[model samples]
Target chain A: MSATHDATHDEAPIAARVRHVEALLEQRGWLAPGEVDERIDALAAGGSPANGAAIVARAWVDPGFRARLLADANTAIGELGLSMAGGLQEQQLIVVANGPDEHHVVVCTLCSCYPIALLGPSPGWYKSEAYRSRVVREPRAVLREFGLELPASTRITVWDASAESRYMVLPRRPAGTDDLDEGRLAALVTRKGLIGTAAV
Target chain B: MPDRFAAGDRVRTGTVDPPHHTRLPRYARGVCGEVVATAGHHPLADERARGLPSTPRAVYCVRFAAHDLFGEGDHAVVVELFEDYLEPAEREVRR
Candidate 1:
């Protein structure tokens, strides 16, 4: 146990602490030696912003899917062969749609809780204390910082993930893309748009 | 347990300042907000953290005006809160 701690000495404090805990779990027969890495690799492999983008593209083209997504996200995503059931608990996913009059943004004020299985890993800024606090306090100002300036007439809604449910923004499709296919539409959907920091 | 709140109900959050884990963020404590929707039952994260046995409780999406919560922004903040963290607020009959 002590040797494992020393073996991670060259790593950062947080990484070392994580390694120490993993080593302890392995030693106690609670986890296999390489199980943690395998799980992490699997998670990384499973998640991607493209998955979210594809869903958005489908929603853009299919009104029925869009309605289904707005009503129940987990089930709607399952229609696309995607799911929020990555780990033990199947987190409740709420899909908030951004409309001409209202825009939606997501933040985990307590921690960096996110729909990672959908949007891939959260951005560095999303986890920053500055974003966690300021976005909730002054969303328009923060969106301005992200180079997004909503019209004065537009209402902003910030979704704080403080419990079991997670949220994702369904950004309105951009204009002049009517000729584009679903794949092209998906290509236009950026991670920031899905997070509601930018318009897609 | 039955849902204690419904969509469109006015509720006020509890100012619970326990040292243990809680899903209710400090920013939302004691604030009055409207219940916009209900998210079905889930175990209390606080109880789970403390190793106390807990039954799943209904969660609600509570919406507060930015002017009410932060005093300046022209927006709304929606926070998902457990049933225990909220109580029926005195109705605001005065607009």
Candidate 2:
């Protein structure tokens, strides 16, 4: 009898549980009806790598903006109306600049904690256990797998997101694109470049 | 609580493994690193994970040399660590 009951209700247990919780929250007056769906939809709609690319493009064109971004990332992004808000607790944004002699890469060994509002959802590989573990241990080798070959002289700094802060890499502006406008430069930036897995 | 660490201070991560949830990565435990920057105070996640009240503690961006950490690389790794995870280590004269 128990086996039959379990067989009939085992499908989509997680989703069913989520609905149950949402219903409970509504019943308790803690959440409005459809609030969960609305929030999820908002997150999904905001998910895009273009957001990060735009920030990079702006930094490439404006020295003052770049300085501000390096000094304080959350406020700097606000100038463009981008924010890391809307979550339960605000996550801090930390921007690390890539220089001629230095490079930056980010990883979350504990989990796939990233700046979703700024960079959209994280790539699948970034959340994979292999990437989470290997990137911090053998960054150059892992970056080599991504086809990023940095010279021995160029130091690679791996930023591990363990706490509330989220990091984004500001790749050095590529050479020979002097005539490009900010929008064009933004178009030239790639998601991988913003994550420091590849160059712009 | 007042901040116990600042940029440029040498510190060592605690090695004793706790049974509860923690953000301290296993590979980084017992390692010596330098405080590169202060990341601001944050509630101790270990306590919060246990459903206990947690006050904000100082956090730091600690930089560890790849060579020292893994015994063979030339680069470096930086981790955002809570104050409770570190202890002041003797300063080294050379890099």
Candidate 3:
């Protein structure tokens, strides 16, 4: 057989590798059986807050700060004392602003890359293979699949986040939110908004 | 080790061999940016990339202009990455 075929045959499946790691961790006493399930449950219960939402709310209330954030996201985020680590540390934070004639969506063509620091661990739908592959190549169509129908005249700016820079979609503030406080504005920012599927 | 770059310092993303652990995205390769801030060290993702033990290393969040990422007229965007994903931005400085 050719070397390529031999290599392919030797490669282990991802699920098996994960299982092996789990077994090794258990054998070494580093992890207890059923601990994985418990940890998963805990993570689910502790839903991460929407960091980008908080930033957007601040921006909507204060135009000057919004300009600063658009100019430099790191400093703007630092103003809020939020640390950038995990996937965020590996990528830049670009807050895409939605306008009357434009909408932005983000995707990682390679994997489920996301701004967990700002938006939290990716939801199940975001991690789906269908979302990753379809979003970058056919954003408008995919948005439709998510039940978001945009105007044909509206321009779609798709942010393909394939590297260390992550993106957060800044949905236009909802009507009647002009007088809302920062806290209330933040509550309106949802993961869907960050993904550019829903407006806050 | 701490970050090799600092806020306001301009740096360029360097190319590294593939099949290596990297926080640098394929799209950001060769892109230039200003070091906006430094994030603390964390377990390296290289271990998972190389099938070895992940080592801890310093990470930083750098900001790149939108024009730099996409072209002119494009608004700016910022990306945070670890030191391992970066190299000296060609122009070395005395730290």
Candidate 4:
């Protein structure tokens, strides 16, 4: 057998590793289940991706700042005090904005690898296996399933997040809100806004 | 791992040599691009084999132009890929 195979075989099973970590954390009294759950609930209800939307909104209003964000996402996002963590930290976090001819969608074929730090925990359907396997290969079809129908002429970009790179779609700005300030624009940029639908 | 490619390095999405665990999508294979900026690496998600204790692996962020992957036109899609998913192109042309 190859050295890598031999090594992997000798190593502890993944389940065992999970149990080991759990046991260690439990022993150390660091696994505060109740408190963690509460914290998650609060963060979720507060709107996790809202912060990202606010940044996008400000960029839209300020040409110079928008150049900065388009040039460098991390630094620009950091200026707003958001650090990519959870699954986002390891991957490239790119904000794909919707243009007149194109629309972007995000999915993880293997699992729900998301930019949770910026976008919060994924919605229920996003984590489902049904969405994962079917989205990348059949984006237009799956998007139709989501009740989003685009013209046949519109190009579709299905971002298959498999590795460290995570993606968040930026929906187009809504009409009638052209005069809205950054604060109002931010409020409009909802979670669905980051999902490439429902302009804020 | 820190960023491996500089601003001008040419790269391509590595072929999916299956029978191994990978996060690369099937559609991304063989696409080419010039490195825009290097995004830092994070953990490796080899959960199927490594299980829970598998620590994160270093990854680099590389950006590909929309025209290269799709086709030439006024409308193009830009894409960024993590390092593990890329391979050095046969000819390295600095863009």
Best lDDT goes to which candidate? Answer: 1
Sort every candidate by DockQ, greatest first.
Answer: 1, 2, 4, 3
Query: What are the DockQ scores of the candidates, in order?
Result: 0.90, 0.81, 0.11, 0.23
**Candidate 1 Cα RMSD after full superposition onto the native fold (Å):** 3.1
True contacts kept of each: 0.94, 0.76, 0.08, 0.24
What fraction of the real A-B contacts shows up in model 1?
0.94
- Interface Cα RMSD per model, in Å? 0.7, 0.8, 6.1, 4.9
Q: Which rank order by TM-score, best down to worst?
A: 1, 2, 4, 3
Please provide, for model 1 over A80-138, each residue's C-alpha lDDT reduced to its tens digit, 9 standing for 90 to 100.
89999876768888999999999999999899989886667899999999999999999
- Candidate 1's residue-wise lDDT over B1-95, tens digit each? 67988998999889779899999998888889999999879889999999999998998999999877766788999999999999999776322
Provide the lowest-lDDT 10-residue window in model 3 chain A: A83-92
Output DockQ, candidate 4.
0.23
Chain B structural similarity as TM-score, candidate 1: 0.92
**Top of the candidates by DockQ:** 1
Clashing residue pairs found in predicted model 4: A90-B42, A91-A164, A188-A200, B41-B59, B43-B56, B43-B57, B44-B56, B44-B57, B66-B77
Q: For model 4, what is the alpha-carbon lDDT of residue A6?
A: 68
Q: What is the lDDT of residue B10 in candidate 3?
A: 75
Of the two candidates 1 and 2, the one with more favorable DockQ, higher being better, is: 1
Per-residue error for A143 in candidate 3, Å, reads: 1.5
Off by over 4 Å in 1: A1-24, B93-95
Q: After superposition, how far is residue B50 of candidate 2 from its true place, in Å?
A: 0.4
